[model samples]
Target: MSTNKAIFTMKLEPELRDSFMAAAAAADRPASQVVRELMRDYIERQRQADEYREYLSHKVQRARAQRDAGDFATNADVEAQAAARRETLLKQAKEAGV
Candidate 1:
């Protein structure tokens, strides 16, 4: 991919701003490079998230079709199950230091 240079302004708490500058200095890279690297990583994560959403959408559609064909949980039951799954994931993340 072709990289284009751009300038942007940001506001940060003083402590965080100072820390970022210090880290950039220690790493021997410009603050711009650090910000750009972070942005690139964030963009990649966003792209993956969008792809995940698309996959989940398709899975949900298929599940709905199955329900129409006579296989499915009640809405309340499904929601409870999803809530439990979310909690499990959250707990796992916490345990993993995320």
Candidate 2:
């Protein structure tokens, strides 16, 4: 029977390694377990960052395409539309007596 465990090796500064060991001991957890958890968290955070960058890239590309196609709104036009909506909402609120 084989255990699902593998050894990972890396080099680190002596001081950092000592500190990590001490902290893990203080927390009453194995240093290897702490390192594994840290690795998992780091991997998850990196994946999320990569996904967000991809999303932002696609959004910028779409915006540029719209602008190139002359399908974008000007700042003034956007402000005017916002103002009209606000005015309509205010009229409705006044009519509702609230």
The lDDT leader among the candidates is 2
TM-score per candidate, in order? 0.65, 0.79
Kindly provide the TM-score of model 1 when superposed on the true structure, using C-alpha atoms: 0.65
Winning candidate number (TM-score):
2
Show pairs that collide, candidate 2.
none
Candidate 2 on 12-80: residue-level lDDT in tens?
Answer: 999999999999999999999999899999999999999999999999999999999999899999999
lDDT over C-alpha atoms for residue 47 of model 2? 100
**Candidate models: Cα lDDT each:** 0.94, 0.97
| Span of 10 residues, lowest total lDDT, candidate 1 | 1-10
Q: What is the lDDT of residue 47 in candidate 1?
A: 100
